[model samples]
Target: MVRNVESSVDDVYEWLLKKGVSQKISQIFRELLAEHGLKQHISDATHRLGHTLDVLITREDSSILKGIPFVADPGICDNNGNRSGDPLAIRTLLRLSKAPRERRTVIFRKIHDINIDNFRKDLDFSSVTYKEASVEKLIIHYNRVLTATIDVHAPLKSKEIVIRPNTPWFTDDLYSAKRDRRKAERLMRRTNLAVHKDIFNQKCMQVTKLIQHCKSQFYINKIQEIGSDSKQLFKLTNNLMGNTNLSVLLEHDSEIDLASKFGEFFIGKIQKIRENLCSLTKSPTREVVLRADIKFDGIPLEAFEPMSIAEVCDIIGDAPTKSCKLDPIPTNVLKQCSESILPIITEIINKSFSEASVPLDFKKAIVRPLIKRQGLDKDEFKNYRPVSNLPFLSKVLEKAVASRLEKYLNDYQLHDNVQSAYRSSHSTETALLRLHHDITS
Candidate 1:
């Protein structure tokens, strides 16, 4: 049943003969191997004593050992590849199959290429009128109208692309330099000129220097930005050292399940906090109020003043052009079309102010889970934190409400003088400086 073997049978026969074994015995041994569907493939002596002790044995019918040649070396080598004294060494090459290319679908809109003037014109012509209705209905109408307008101008498109590992330091400058280097190399090869050769070498050196500068600058900026955040800094360091790896999943696990698991963990955590608060409220603390005798009558804030169209336009213009998938229009598009959309947005805010209720749509947010830091168990829910990305319009409305609330607080002098958080020109740094001054004085 055996067809072939990849070992030197003739070399083994000669070694057997040199070992003083009879020719008849060697023939019998070969016949026995054939009868058993087995073959010995080691043709050369494996030991220093000229004995073929180490041999590659395989089934004659099997192709697994076929096309594989082994080199029998009498010694080992050091790090510099120089041979050192050793018992023996067998070297062989094993070629493994290439890994399959992984692909993912990217859905995006070409927001940069949009003509803002045309978009504003389209919005001016579009009807966003709604009848007197509940705030919920009005919010739904606003989202639908703006989403439809954006779809007409900048429709979403999907493309499948191969996923590859990339360095964070890679930039457009490096890409252009690499392209120029390729052109120079091609010219050098085609022309066979000394000038072209020198140009190619110079381009190579330039690219190398550019890459080093970019990598160093990337790390330097990253360290400065995250210097105050130790957790983030450690994560960046671990990623740079190549110690971090992606989370692995089992065959039965799906991304949806993982998301649900994270959601449940957060919900349970909030429930625990609520339970603790309820228990504490049932048994009140005996602490005394520090400013119980300081009583000043200040006008209480009952309702928020409605924001005007100009105020709404200013808010949108000043806000960052960061968008979420839930947003009906990208922030930049909204800003550009502010003149046309301000009236509706102003109405929505006024309606919300009079009703004393935020729209349900505004309350919705897309939550993503991220690991708290590197070197933590990725599978554990406690190690991950939830980050909510809210729609751009929701943020605009929030800024409007915060502005009114802040004005009320300032008008009555209701806030504590030493309070640092959420106050203009105040931060932990200022708080620490004040503490230091108090101690010194």
Candidate 2:
């Protein structure tokens, strides 16, 4: 009866293990087993099992765990007054794991000399005590506080350039108002160069045309009187030149008066056009790329993804699996994720979340459903089954899949109406490809 009960308990423990029960629960079970003198039986049962079982049962179990009071040991002080290799002291220092060896050594030396009680008192956390916290928890708390501090001060650090008020020019009372007006006119002209350029170009062309027309009219009227006295003609031409000069001076003054009156409206219109262009340039636009790969029993077969030059470099460096499996198909289907299929999927998920403007937790929501639908564990790749010897059909199906994914990603709009369309399209494409392959075989 005792043996049967022991077996039953073991079975319950195994069931809980499969369900991913907490370490505390597992430890409690182990204690119960030890109390029943079934520890020997468990040892025998787990003799052939991997060491992972032992580690999990020991380190992860909190029920049998006792909190240890951290004691400070004295030593020499470094520049930062932090100690090395001591987890508690390291946590107190808030030093990054990736700190330089020299820096770490200094930190270690400094922390080793500190009096724990006095240090705690110095911090003056009367409301909060560092009494019974693990190294991991301490590190996490420090990081949180540091992050909060940075966030609070971030806005003040961001200095934006602004236009300052113009200083008034010093002048005599007689010409001060007139001088100020002239200065204002000059400032306006200098600032609105594009508007002035357009106006000047247009008016210059108009003036040139008017001068040509006048010259043409004079020549046409005298065409039949070519034999008239040359001296008399020269005198007449000089008089006409004088009259033209006077007329041009009057026209110039009139144009300047017109500009003084209406220049603001033209300049404002130009400025508005520029501001519109600037806003358009800064507006967000969707940039989509389809990346897909087919794997045959975990080994990548074909990979393709339409990528820019910078993306290509990143893909080469980070995604070696993609480099190995070059896509053979000539279709628009480019295979993308080849290095680690999981990371590729994660990248896709991230892109989707970003496009949707949803929190990253949505990734977990989508991933769980997809994993369940596939009836595969998150780490279950060992049992992956490859499609049988239908090389041509497989290639065709893969290409079709790529094409469908590309089209969907490219056209997907993250609006309420079309948000699910990409996901639906992907599913449909995969299903159809599977069906077609099955029927053909």
Candidate 3:
């Protein structure tokens, strides 16, 4: 993966040589240097926790509404209840100070198992109010099992351990080879003898070849796993190429301040949509009355019914996993699930549409600010546009709604021909053709 977007900010200073890119762009890079540290904390948390949580924050008060414990660094064992370090840490260390690496690993694993018993983590959807396997209950239960397993296996959270952006694919053997290569490089730098030079060169070359081979194999496996999904392939490439990392402004040094700044600029913008004023319209003028009377009769409707297992399977199967919306349970996993499980999933989708109510959890969105262009002012928040990420489950629910709604619209022909942009299978070319036909007519 790429080191960081702002990791090379010092090089921006050397851009004093070339007057090509504008000073404003360079300043933006400089201001973004603070994001590197924030990103380091985020990365470390992800590594330790197996999965990352989207901190529900609004700039309104600049406080995290949930999951602050997950984001904060797990510094020295004060044991204030973040499901962190052993309460008996000093005692345990005194007992096992001379333990071997293998024994230490075993001991920590036991400690982690014990920690799970004592620490009361928040209940995600699965474990909450679960008694019997109803549609929602079964779905959430399956997700809970998978989620708990993943959380159980995640690296033990720690503080200030050098957060290296080491590739997840790196093995102990490769790491050892890399260490040896570094040693060889250092030795060659210090020595002058021909014997030393030859041995160092051979050893370095072998290590270099092994490293290249390992990296190639790792990426190849990843590509095969992604398998013809161009978007996921592109995301993997971008991680290596360093494109997706967000730059944090130095003015907002800590994430807390950035959260506050972002909230200040954005929270007020979230206006509650006004109530349906049209429903309360006491009087309609002549033009509005005439327009209301003018309606086109559409193809007759069949009774609307629930989606089928086959249809549900198709929708899940076609879902693109490239979307950055992470969820407790991923759609990719859902797609690959056994056919027998499809009916339960279909039941969940059916009841959701039948009731026409979506949970508030589905509606919550995480906003990430993206810089629009090269000359954006570093100091101004307005230069950035917000791109919101939704949970994968929300998108799946959205797709279910759209499918049912589209069928309804098609049956009644309520969709206007002029709306070529959002209509399935319509394009800019179709819009142009329609315009040309109208002109000729």
Candidate 4:
């Protein structure tokens, strides 16, 4: 992030340099230098807390020279014959001791570069170090601000309701059990409905308040009434609305009809508010579902045929020889088998329209396995394997493993010594292969 910021600034600087604005830019550089010099002076003066104490002590004495103690050399002789110590330093210390008591108000005013008298009027400085002030004033001022800002009220109100049934004579203990159970169930249902209604109402009210708050007139009015503590008012209002008990409101609703009506009204209002807000702002961008087509050259392949596991093993033969003796199948026969069995391969190559050849090693490795797995005899041309039996072949082909292997082999270009070793190894392997062929024959 810092590098990016530096790069952006450098770009602007370079642009300015090209435009020949170096002389004009020096004005800003000079202002920055002045600021740095002021900062250095402040840093040197307040190198430690002791330095602050010295400044405070010295500032109190109007008669003391500014640079006397700081610049005075004790080694140098003065005309006053004060060989024991630096005369200027001694005089400055004496003057500081004799000076009038320093007022914190005056010091703070000077440091802040503000008028002390006016600032004191605007702020309650009883807790601050003014020479004459009572602690009670500080407490009162602090309490007033705290009381104005903080909410100390409970938001919920509770009430109990007594329900009398339509039938009065059903008052026996057994009857009362049945009656009470029904009443309790009804009350529970009502309470739940009321609670839901209350929550919905509160949500709607919040949306309404938010809309009102967004209005310029409402914000201005609120600020005018609350002064600088409008934030406290908004927070208190939100807390009060959030804490309001919906269950209490629900208990007052006698019938389910009334509860349902109120719930619908609240929901409708919320929906309307949502629509209004959404319309005023930009509608959210819809998520685009990306899909890719597996096209062979220009057209989708109608059939797919994969190499069987047996074919794979055949291609990567377990023989100890450097290379296995492959069966000499005719090119036309192999091409026909490729077209009929390896439909997936054909599909990948865009329905045999592609110019690229199926790699010889890959065809041997993959196709044989698929054919074997499908339980098809390689010699029997009558029994061809179904394309759907081997779905994994298509996935394997998609991996581009052959391309990766080719890249790896190409990248392994041998250095001089490594090349010599590789060539020697190759020669020995070739000689062994020839001898093995003769012996096996």
Best by lDDT: 1
Among these predictions, the greatest TM-score belongs to 1
lDDT of each: 0.79, 0.38, 0.58, 0.38
lDDT of 2 by residue, 1-441 (tens): 347335545655676788899768977976965665442212212222311122112232333323331223334356797643221120012223443332111111122333444333333112223345433333334334423432332212323343443323222432444454455556557887776656555555555565566566656566446557787677657755664222111124475563353445445656999999888777788333444343323323233333233443343334223211112211111222122222322233233323433222221211001122243443432222222222221232234344435554455432233233445444665667767888999
TM-score of each: 0.68, 0.11, 0.49, 0.12
lDDT per residue as tens, model 1, 1-441: 122232356456777998999999989878878799887765555656554555666677766652665545666789999986444655555445679889999998888888888877766423444446666777777788777777887899999999988889999999999999999999999999999999999999999999999999999999999979999998998988997756533223587887777778889999999999888667766454466345769876789988988899888888988998898887777777787888878888888889998888888889887778777776677887888999887888899999998899888777787899999889999899999999999
Ranking by TM-score: 1, 3, 4, 2
Give the per-residue Cα lDDT of candidate 1 at 6. 27
Kindly indicate the candidate among 1 and 4 with the higher lDDT: 1
Model 4, residue 20: distance off in Å is 15
- lDDT (Cα) of model 1: 0.79
**TM-score between candidate 3 and the true structure:** 0.49
Better of 3 and 4 by TM-score: 3
- Candidate 1 clashes between residue pairs 3 or more apart in a chain or in different chains: 7-41
- Expressed as tens digits, the lDDT of each residue in 100-219 for candidate 4 is 543332111122333334322333223433123233332233334322322121112344434433332222443544454555556656787776565555555554554454444544
Instruction: Report the C-alpha lDDT of model 3 over 23-113, residue by residue, as the tens digit.
Output: 7776765555444433221222122323322221123333333433233433454456455432111111112244333312221122223
Candidate 4 TM-score over all chains jointly:
0.12
